[model samples]
Structures are given as C-alpha cells and as structure tokens.
Target: MGIVLFALLLVAVVLLEVNDSFLNPQFYSDTLRDADIYNFALNDLPRSALDEARLIAPQYIDPSLDENPLVSAGLTTGDFVAALNRALPPEWVQDMVEQVLDEPGDYITGERDDFSTRIQAGDRVVLVVEEIKTLTRQADAYNLLFEQVIFPNIEDALETELPFGIDVTAERVAEAVRRVVPPEWVQANVEAALNAVTPYVVGETDTFEVEVQLSERVDVALEEIKSILLESDAYDLVYDEVVEPIIKDALGPTVALPFNITISRVEITDALREVAPAQWVQEQAELIVDATGQYVTQETDSLNIDIDLRDNKIAARDVLVRLAREQFDRVANDLPACSNSQLGSLVTSGLTSLPECMPSGGTAIEDQVRGVVSDTINSLQRQIEDAVDTALLAQIPDTLTFTDQTLKDQLAASGASDNADLLDDVRRIIGEGWTYTDQDLRADLLDFDSQDSVDLLDDVRSFLSDGWVFTEQDLREQIGDADPDVLAKLDDGRRIFKQARTWRFLVYFPVLILVVIIAFLGGRAWWGRVAWAAAYLTISAAAIWITFGPVYSALSGGGIDRARQEAIDSIEPNHDFANTQALIIDKAIDTGAFIIDGFAAGVATNAIIVFVIGMLILSAAIVWPRLSEYLYK
Candidate 1:
C-alpha cells in the first residue's frame, strides 16, 4: 500500500512539474531570454525576413516592365531592400522582437486577449522612398546604374540580336556601310565621268571662273568625303575592322577594342557638310550642338537607337539638293563646252559613238545629265537617309542626364505606361522631401476608430487588402470544417492552465498528507517508520530516474535530429542568407534540444540524489541495530 501510494505521489509530482513547465509564464519568459534564442531572433531573423521579401518582391511588379532595361537593371528589389536595411534602425527590430516576446507571456497570463503585436511598416516604407529620392538626386548613382547594369544589357542585346553578326562595334558598323556603299563603285563612276569630260577641256584658261571640270570636281568631292569620314572617327573604325583579324592573330586575343564608339547628330552633320554642304543641315546640327541632348540620350556603351526619319526630312532633302548641285555644276562647266574639232578627233580615234558633239537645236548635254542625276538622287533619297541615320543613331553617347522625368518619358514611349504611372505615383508620394510621418501614414493608409486609435490587426489587414472587402463569411469559409470538440478541449485546457498555480497548491497538500499517512502506517517504531519511508523513497526515485533519463532520451533522440534537419531543409536555396539562416535554425534547434536535455538531466540527478539519501537511511536502520547488539555482546 505504501509503495503504491509513493508511486502515485511520484506520478502526481511529474505531471504537475511538466504542466508548470509548459503553462507557467515564467518558464517561457526565462527560456526565451536565454542567450542563444534571444540573440538568434534579435540579430538574424529580421535580415533573413528582408532578404526573403526582396526575393519575392519581383512577382508583385507590373509584368509589362519585366523586359524593361530599367526594371531588369536599375529597378531591383535587392537594391531597394539593401537601401531599406541601411536606413532602418537596428533598435526598431529589437523593439519589435521585445514586444513580441512579451506577448507570449501576456497571453499565457491572461493579460492580453490575442497573441499579436503591431509592427508599423509604414515608417519603413517612407524611409525606403526617401532612400530612393536620395539615390535619384545623386549623379554617381545614376552613372553606376548606366555603366554597370544598363550598358552591359544593351551591349549583350546588340551583340546577339544585331544583323551585323556577333560584333556590334563601330568597326562592324563601318564594314556594313562599306558593303552597302562600296568605295570601288564611287571610284569607278568618277573615272568614267572624268573620261567623258576630258575631250571638252581643249585648254586651260585663266579666264574660266570654274578651274576644275566634272572629273576633277568629283575627285575633290571624294577627298572631301574621305576627310569627313576621318573627322567623324569612321576612318579609324573602318581601319580597325580591316586590320582586326591580323591584330587578333598576332596578339593572340589579348587586344581589346580601342574605345566605345558613339556618333551623335553633330558628327553626322559635319560628315554630311564635307560630302554635300547645305544650309539646313548646318542649322539642324547647330540646334543639336549639345550632343548630350535629352531626346537623343544614350544610357549604354553600345548603340541602341529607334529612328524616325520623318523628324529630319528637311535635313535629308538638303543633303540630296547639295549632292545634285555639285554634280550639275560639274557637268555644266565641262560637258557643253566640247569643241567640234575634239569631237572629230574622238570619232577618228574610235572613241565616239554619237552623231554630233552636242544635241541639235541648242539642246545642252549638261541639262539632260543634271536632270537624270537629280531624278536618280530623288528616287533613292529614302534609302540614303536611312543608311546615314542608322549609322548616326547607332553611335552611343558617352554621357546622359538621368532624371525621373526622362525615365518616365522613356518608359511610356517604350509601351511601359503602367511603370511610368507607377513612377509618377512614387514621385507624388515622395514629393520634394521626407514629408510623410507615422501619424500621416496611420491616417491615410490605416483604419481608425472613433477615438482615432488604430486596431493593429485590423489596420494591417485593411492596408494589405488595398481596399478589398473581406467579411466574416470569407473568414468562416477559409476556416471551414473546424472540429467543435477540439475547440471545447482547447477552452478547457486554457481554463486549466489559467488555474494551474492554485491547482499546484492543492496537489502539493494532498501529496504531503499522503506521505505522512504512509509514514505512520508503514511501521510502529520511529526507526521502522524511517526504514519504511526510505524504502518507498528509494523505489520512487529509481522509477523517476529510469523514466526521465534513458527512457525519455530513447524516445526523443532521433526525432530531435530529424526535426533539426527538416527545418534546415525547408529554407529556400535561392535565399541570399540561406546558409546563415540554416545555421541559425540549426543552432536554435540545438539550443532547444540542449534545454530539454538539461531539464531531463536535472530531473535524473535529483532522482539519483533522493535515491542515495533513501538508501543511506535504510542501510542505517538495518545496520544500527546489528552494530549495537555486537557492541553489547
């Protein structure tokens, strides 16, 4: 009976202690305050959360901006989060964690109705916007974005997608121009015209206002073209293209391109003046003197242009007219002045196929040739303009003014209206400076009651919903098929936990009364009572030691390891801090296991100590009587 009562008392003590460990507020508070868990939550969790948010943020951006160079390059969630992390105070996160830690204790002790804390992300959102403003204002930041991200992407796109086959350099462009307008064709045409006009130059006359004839003029014009090409950097580029292979072979692929080539409208106009001088082109070039103009901006190392020749029709027409005038003046001076004697010589020499030196009835050869050439140039002006414009536009700029308005305009032009509008909205929100405060955020974005105090969860839910309504029915549907019995049991458990401290005293008094009754009933004498109590204690302690020590470890050992591994596995591989987060999780699990192991070891040690005390008392009870009898004998 004594042994059974002692066993009952041991079971009661174990149950009460376990219940107190779980239900007591102090147990949780003390455990959470431990250095390992406290530091892990404080230091690591917030950064991991921010990283996780950055990874997922792209999904929420407008799909239209997915392929946008800015979106792909300058507008990155990682950068935004990095800025936020820099601007955000470390104490803010610490305060939040401290508040959250208090909630568990508060809820358990019935001090709070719910286990939720309000984390105001509004101020942080404003801080991020302010950071963006700061970034926008800095020239170096824009330059970095252009040089590092935008330019590289543009280079890659040009290299792969351009029709010039892999190399998108200025040399490749010059080579393509050479193919389209071959230098050989120009030389051949000039030779044929010079031969046709040679017979007309009977003698060199000092009286002639025009010293050079058609062929000489064409040669001078070609020289002018060459000079223009050289001045515009095209000559060097073409030279590089021609000798690139030889250089590569000699250098064994170590040689880089000389520099990133970019030709603006000013370069094109200057080149045009050499070949076809005209007033309108000069005027247009003067207007666009600031090669770093907003409309013709370049954000990358490689040339990427979207040309519309309609905007430059007058300039194109002026180029054509200048070319025609030069050709006409050449023909008029030399072709009509051919002497009859020279014509006869040409016939006798088998160089003439025409019936007369000039057409009969005062018809001039110069007028006919001039008309034909003008018609030809007019017919092919579109093709000429396209080729020249392409070459000009393909030249990327060395610098660009990166402003918010410029970005918006570019985005809108590229069919990213949503992104443009989004930028506008951001600009509106941020304004000139950091204007929005916490109270303003609460007033605008969050919901408030009559007293102007916001309910944390309600405000959070409302803000996240973005004006979408979610009723009680929606919540009920979400939580469908909840078991009533489970809910009732939860309520019962809460009540029991709430009254545990009072129940602990009740249990302690009953166990003490039982111990007293067992001691009295076990034996008649005081020594016999001590022996009986000691035997009961020894048996009970042995049971506790076996149960908490080896038995508990045997059940939980593999499970703890598997749980830790599973937790580590659950972290996403794409997370930037995946390794660190996994380490933190592993450490947290190890810390928890350590706590459990420590508790079990402490229980086992106490059991062993009680067992030792009880065994000593029982031994004394048996040995003392024998020792006394031996002494008496």
Candidate 2:
C-alpha cells in the first residue's frame, strides 16, 4: 500500500512539473521575451532563407544589373533630335511644314496633297490668312510700281516737243520718232499694248465699231481743223502756245515727279517685306496652329514607350537617339549634302509646329519633340515602378511555397555541380517544396518564420522611400559553419511553439488542485507526503532543462555570427531574384540571431516556471503539518 501510494504521488509530481516545462502556455509565452532563445533562432534565418531562396531568381528578391539597363541609355536632347530626325526624316518634316504653310483655311475642303490636307479638318483659318496676305502683297507691289515708275514716265513723254514744217508735219514727225525708237523699246511698247488690250480681248465689247467711229472722228477733225492739225508748222505753233503750258500746269506735279523718280526693284521688294498680314489673316493662322498642336499633342499622348531591360538606361529614347546620331554624325563628316546649320533647321522643323513659347524663327518643333519624349518617360516611370513592386512582392509568393528546381538550376549555373553534398544539404535545410507568403515573411523565425526577407529587404525600402531603418548589430553573434541537417531539425523542433499552447494556464490550475488533493488524502503525515511529492516534481522539471539545453544551443548556432552564410553563396543574380545581397545577408544574420535568442528565452521561461512551482510545492509541504494540526484542534 505504501509503495503504491508513493507511485501515485510520483505520477502527480510528474504531471505538475513535466507539463509545465514542455507543454505549458504561460511558460512559452514568457519564453518569447527570453534573450538567449531569441539569439539562437536568429542564427538560423540566413541559412534557412538562402537554402530556399537560391533556387528561385535573383530579380525576385535581389537587385540585378539587368534591371538597371537604363543607366547607360544616356539620352539627351541632342540625341533625341538626331534620332527622331532619322526615324521620321527631316526632309519629310520640311516638306510637311511647307505644305502646312501653304494650306488654305478649310483643310478638309481642299485637295489631299495640298497644305490644307495636312492641317486639321475644321481649320480654314490658315487658308484665309494666306489668301489675304497674297492679295495684300500684290496690291502693295502694284502701288509701288505705278506711283514711282510708270505714271511719271507717261506724264513726261506727253510733254515732249514736236517739230512743225511743211515736210515735217505732225504725222511725219510722229513717223520719224517711231523710226528712231529702239526695236527693243518698240517690242516693249507692243507688249504693253497687248497687256492693256487683254481685258478688252476677253470681254464682250465692240472692238470694230469703236475703231470705225474713232476713224470717222479723226477724218472730221482733219476736215474741220486742217490748218492747225494737218499743217505741221501751224500745229507746232499752237501746241507751244496752248497745249504745252496747260498740260504742264495740270499734270506735271502729279505724273512728272514719278517719271523722274529713279528707284531700284530691290527697294520695292524690301518695302513690301515690311508689311505684315492683316489681322483677319492672323486669326486664320492661329486656327491652323491650334489644329496642328491638337494633332501633335494627341500623337505624343498616344506614344507608347518603355525602357528596355537591355537598354542599360532609364529609357530607350537615349540609346536609340545616340545610335542614330552617331550614324548621322559619321556620315556628316563626309559633308553629306546638307550643311550643319541647314541640318539643324531641318531637324527642328521636322520635330513639330511652332510653339507658343517660341518665335517664328525659334526651334519649337525640337523643344516639342523633347517634351513629348520626356512626357513618355515620366509616364513609363510609374508603370515600371509598379511592375517592379509586383515582381518583388511576387518573389515572396501569395501562398507559402519553395522548390529545389531553382536551387538545382542555381547549382548548375555556378559550375558547382561536382559538389554532390551541397544539393542534399540544401534539400535537407529547405525540404523539397514549400509554398510561403507575406504572413511567413512577417512571422518570427524562431516562432516559425522570421519574416525571412524582412531583414535584408528592409534596405530595399531605402531606395524606394525615405524612411527609418534598424541599425544596431555589433554584438549580435551569427551562426558560423553550422550543419544543414542539424539546423533543419531545429526548424522542425520549433513546432513546440504550437504544442506548448494547447492547454492554457487555466487548464493547468485544475490539474494543480487535483495533485494537491490527492497528496493530502494519501498520507496522514502531511509534511512527509508533500516533501516527497515536491522532490519528484523538481527532478522531472530539472530533467527537461538538461535534455533541451543542447538542442536549443545548436539551434542558436553556438553564438557565432556567420554560421550558415556560405549557404547563400549558391544563389545567382537574375531577373527574378534581384536584391541587395550583402545587405540581405547581414540583415538575415541579425534577424535570425534575434529570433533564436527569443526561443531560448521562451525555453528558459518554461524552465523557470517548473523550478518555481517545484519550490512552492516543497515550501507548502513544510507548512502542511501545522495547518492540519490547527484544523484538527
């Protein structure tokens, strides 16, 4: 009976102490604050993550050279101008500008090949402006020529003296004058006559009737005034006395000065150049400008441009421009038909229409072209940023997942295929396949997962956003030269994290009450019974601590800082795994170390709880005799 009772008490002690050490929630919760346990888990992270990370891709979580290809694109305005000209060609641009200039007001109403077709359909302003300008120029030229040259010459000729004699009659003198006239002069006169007759020739007028009437009138004049008109001496005397003075006084001031005025054709042209188009004409020009701008703006907005992964710059515009410019420059050395100044103008003209900010002679098109490309680049920047974010986020996976295929490919890419042990070691550490996610990333490594990439990837945010960062790490030791197979066991052993919380503190309280009740009923000597029960509990609790110490120590990586850094070497940089590798390794070390330390703390807490409970049981046993004596009295 005594032996049986002792065994029952021993079972009760084991239940109370052993459960607290290995399966108690209160102990494990406190263990989270344990520094030594956290340090141990922290040491396991880098090796654990890389062992899984190496197989995937560098771009997924790593920063790679390929992602920054735009760094070398180096596009400037000059390059843009050069490349755009080649792609679109300056000749096409020049001709298009000429066409645009010549177009009429109603673009849609004109011929397809005409300038009007190049403008917006609703634009008729350009045509109206051009027409008014052309008419104004004609009117100015006519006024300059007639007022300064033709009118004066005619007035002067009308005042010239005529000889009068029996043989040198008016008609005879006129014939002599005609014979003396230069043949070229005569031809010129004939041409002038033809020009005067042109309107009449094409009109509905009676040419013969007027000529016959004028002939009859001349015959009547000869019959009526033969003495003065037909007799040359008589007629000369009359003209000098009457006609010359009268004509000179009336017409000389107006027409004579013009005949004497000697002005060059160049002066006339220069004067006309000073004249600007009318206000109405300018309004029309504005419409054409608006239409062209709308078209160009639409074209630029729709332009789809992306920075190539191979371009080695922020965008493709620069590299493309540079190449085209280089080619053009090479040809330019040979004095290609176009001069430098001419080429520049052609390129500018080809780029677009004149801008509001530019003068008529300014390089608006070139500026506009640059603006368009810049707009495209700015737009692409956002998309690229978003795509990069998606790509990096994808590296973590939505569901928890990992595979050895990448690890295998990584091994082959590194030319390390000869090492058969590396693959097996990696497989043991990460397992064959595991799907992971953001939850895993945010989880504690010692608790289950030390948000694997949270440490190293934290620096990635430095470039992404201006924010705070963790900096303390001089004393935190990392695991160095650890066995993969052994660490993986630790990863599995962390399952205790879940198991420890199955029965909470409330459940354990009832069990404690039952143990005390059984101890009191089993023995009449209260001191002896409680003392033996406490001893059994203490022994059981101490056994758990002794057994778990080495396992937790191995998990903590012997307090070394670089235990499994070598494992990270297997991963290769690529599109999928692009990360700042050195920073990640360091961060992983710090994170993994801290996590293992937490686990160690939790374990120590459980040990402390068991030890404390054992001591309380022992103290209660010494007091039980006095309490029982008092109760019985």
Candidate 3:
C-alpha cells in the first residue's frame, strides 16, 4: 500500500508538471492570436492610403526643394518652350537687318556711309533677341538636368542614408565666421562693400567678381573656421580621418573637405515584441508565479488539518492556534526591544506592528494564521533557493539558463533527504545557473570598479523594467510577440514552487509527528536531534554574511575604485568620495531580520523532521513488549 501510494504521488506530480507547462504565462496562445489579427489588417489596407496621407500631412521637408535657387521661378517644362519662343526676334526685324546689310548703298544715300552703319540699329535689335534666346536655352538645359538626375538622386540619397560627415553651405560658413570674428572685422566688411559699389557698368561681368574682392574678408573668415574645426574633436576626426581619406582616394591628392552637417536627434521607439511567443508563454507563467507564490505558499490555515501541538500537550487544533497567536501578541504588545548597535531602534520600530502575525477574530484571523504559517514555510524555501542563486549567479556565465537552473534546483533542493543531498542541491543549482541570460551573468559586472559601468547596467535594467517599449512594438508588427523572459522565469518558479509545496504537504504531517516522538525519546547522540537546534543558527549567520559582508563588499569596492581613478585623473583633484564609503548599515539590519526569519522557519520545520526520527528511535528503545513475549513463546 505504501509503495502504491508513493506511485500515485509520482503520477500526480507528473500530471501537474504537464498542466503547468501548458497553462503558464510564457505560453504563446494569446500573442499568436494578436499577431494573426495584426497581419490581416496590414494585408487588407489599401496601398494608396499611406501615400495620400503622407502627401496631405507633409511629414518632413524635402531638403532638395529647399536647396534649389530657382524655387520662385516656378517654371515647368511647358514654360521653358514658351520662354524660348518669346526670346526669338520678330521676323520683320530680322528681315530689315538683312536688307540693310545687303544693300548698304540704298540705305546710306551717300558713299561715306558704310554697311555696318546702315544696319547698326537692326543689329542691336537682333543681338537682344539672340541674347534672350541663349539665356532661355541655358535655363531649359538646367531644368532638364535637374529633373532627370539631380533631384531624383537627392531624394533617393536622403531616403537611403544617414547624414554624412560634411554638409558645407555658404550661410553655415558665414555663421561660423560671425561667431568668432571681432566687431572690428564686421565693420571693415561693411565699409569695404560700401566703397566698392561705385560706377556700376552694364554688360560688365568682371565688375561683380571685383566687387566681391570679398576674398580678403573671406580669408579672415577662413581662419575663424579653421580655429573652430581644430577645437572640436568630432569635427577634426571627421575632416582628418574619414573625409580626407575618401577625398584623397578619389581626387588623387590629399584634400581638406569642408562639411556642414545638420544633426537631428532621432530615437528608435523600441517595443517588447521581439521575444518569441514560445519563450513568452513560459515567462508569463513564471511572472504569475512570482507575483502570487508567496501568498499561496504561506497560507497555513488552508492546510488539510488546522492542527498544532506544543509542549507535549494535544488539545483541539483551534485551541493550539489560539495559544500560538496569544504568545505572539504578548511578545509584540509593547514596543519591540532595541539595542544600542547599528541600525538599532529602526528594526525594533519596524517590528512593533505584528499585523501579519496577529490573529484577529473570525475568518480573517483564520486566514491570517494560515497565511503566516505558509509564509513561514515559503520563506525557508526562499532562503535556501536565494542562497543557491547568489552563489550560482556569481558563477553563471549566461542569464537565460541561470534562471532556469535556479528554478529547477529550488524544487529538487526542497526534497533533500540529508545534509549531503542539501549540499549537492546547492551545487547543482549553481551548475545550472551557467545557462541563464547575459543579463544575469553580467549582474555582477555592475560591481565593476567603475561607476560608468555600473550606470550602464542600471540603464539596461531600467530598460527591462520599462518593458523594452520600442522593441515591443516592433515585435508586435513583425512577429507578434511580447518580451517573455520575466514571464518564463515566473512560470518555472511557480511550477517548482507548487511541486515543492505538494511534497511538503504530503510529508509535513508525518514528519511533524515523527519529530515529536524523537524529541521525546531520542538519546543525546542523535545528530538529527542536534540539527533541529543548530539549523537556524547556521542559516542565520549565512544570511547575515550575504546581506552585510558580500553585498557591501561588492558595492564599496567599485565605489572606492571610481574615487581613486577620478582623483588621479583630476587636474585639481578633489577626493570627495575618497574615504567616504557607500556602505549602508541598514543592509546589515535587514540581513539580521532575514536571519531571524530564516531561523524561525528552519528551526520549526527541522524540529518536526527530528521529532519523527526521534519517535522511531523511542519506539525501538521501548522494545515493543509484544515482540518480547513472542520471542519467549
């Protein structure tokens, strides 16, 4: 019967495992549905709708259109042809010019008048028309080239590339010069330009170039530009490292390229969608467990039997419960005792309220009683798991597998039958931690000797905490999933917890009874008996080390290094954090509380286990009188 019962227990555990796998948070069902719906909408949308909206909305300015000098001309292909035709001289003017030149004698009426003189007026009219035609032709050619190549290339380039190194423009250069040059230089330019605008002649192209002998002022402006470039590392790097090389390669000479790049800050809005749905299903399950496991694990009143026995006395279970609650009340009725040590009265004050431990009247009280017990059990389990996790987390190389192993080890560790098994379980959890995420492995990287590195880790954690918003949306669009690591961890944690709970439920009562018996009759030499007394003390000390020594050491080491480096690097060194450690004494206090809690739970549970073993020994020691009678017969 015992074997059958054990087999049934095994089967039930297996079934629970299967159910957990399917129903957990990291499961992919909901996300898959969402993905399908999103894809359908995208496929059904009209192609032209997006384009028409963009045209109406004018999302961004066309840099090419803005850069063009002829925007105001507003000339189209048709306008070019009309302008060309209008520029041609009238047929009558052309004919008159020809006739006068061919018959110079008739036009002059005198031998002294030459052909050149006769047609000079007509020649002027023809020349004006010809000049107009030439200008119109040139404009037409420019417009054709702009349409066919320059405009298209600019548009395509804008779409395909990030802003390059250099963006030189006349105004940008002028702005650079204005920023640096003295007031005297500006006054000189104003005076020089004013002096140069005299006796302007028509049809004199050379006059414009000389007017802008503006080169002398520009020379001074160039010095200001060079100075600015020299001051900016980014500018110097772009000019010397990237642009200079590219220009030298193409032009067959080393050349300095001037660039005036406009920098616009653009952000990629990441959403939490990239996590695979399979993984997500797992994460979701884990998250649910993380959020609620403590409540469920700690619910004591809901235990199969609401029974408590103390001091070798057996009364109604409810009566025992009342006695326990009363004891707790008496202890907490006054302000908690305080010591003159570190974080002294703070912990005492924090513990003054025992609402979680207090048993009110009625169902709430019943529930609270149960909750406290269950929470106690869960707390013990958590302590064991956390110890294993911390040790393993330090050793783990990856984060993805770390959480997975930690979850598994937590379940198996709870079932530990002896000291060896418990220690083995701890080691297994650490070994398994090797498989977790890069984030998990890198958690200690924050303990690096640099605040900058620590800050980077913080940023990553903050990003995760913020739900990876940008990636989430993209995942929604691309594959239809949300980030699932947290959810998966929660799911695995819950399943392991539930398994552990089930085992505890099956064993707790029998174990408690047996422990009671052993405590009654077991000899002093029983080490199991010794375990009950010392389990908490050992665990409590370990917790203290974890909370105070290790944690403090990790944080302080990094802070000190940063202070030292900054001191060395400083021109006028100020060692502000030099001797001021970042250590918080409160962490040690918290550790103390944690140790107390761990001790309470471990001692209580082990007492039951030891009691069971003690009872068996006592039974053997009593020598079953019936067995002696049978032996004599």
Candidate closest to the true structure, highest lDDT: 1
Which has the better lDDT: candidate 2, or candidate 3?
Answer: 2
Native-referenced Cα lDDT, model 3: 0.35
Which ranges in model 1 have alpha carbons more than 4 Å from their true place?
Answer: 1-7, 41-95, 101-144, 147-149, 152-284, 288-490, 508-517, 542-585, 601-633
TM-score of each: 0.42, 0.22, 0.15
Ordered by lDDT, highest first, the candidates read 1, 2, 3
Clashes of 1: 1
* TM-score (C-alpha, index-matched) for candidate 2: 0.22
Measured by TM-score, the strongest candidate is: 1
Model 3 lDDT at residue 313:
20
Candidate 3 segments whose C-alpha is farther than 4 A from its true place: 1-73, 76-92, 95-98, 101-117, 121-209, 213-633
Task: State residue 19's C-alpha deviation in candidate 1, in Å.
Answer: 3.0
- lDDT by residue for model 1 (60-166), tens: 54332233333434445445445655556555655555655566554544444456555545445445445755544432344444444444555454444221012
Evaluate all candidate structures by whole-model CA lDDT and list the values in order: 0.48, 0.38, 0.35
Query: Worst 10-residue stretch by lDDT in candidate 2?
Result: 470-479
How would the candidate models be sorted by TM-score, starting from the highest? Answer: 1, 2, 3
Q: Candidate 1: what lDDT?
A: 0.48
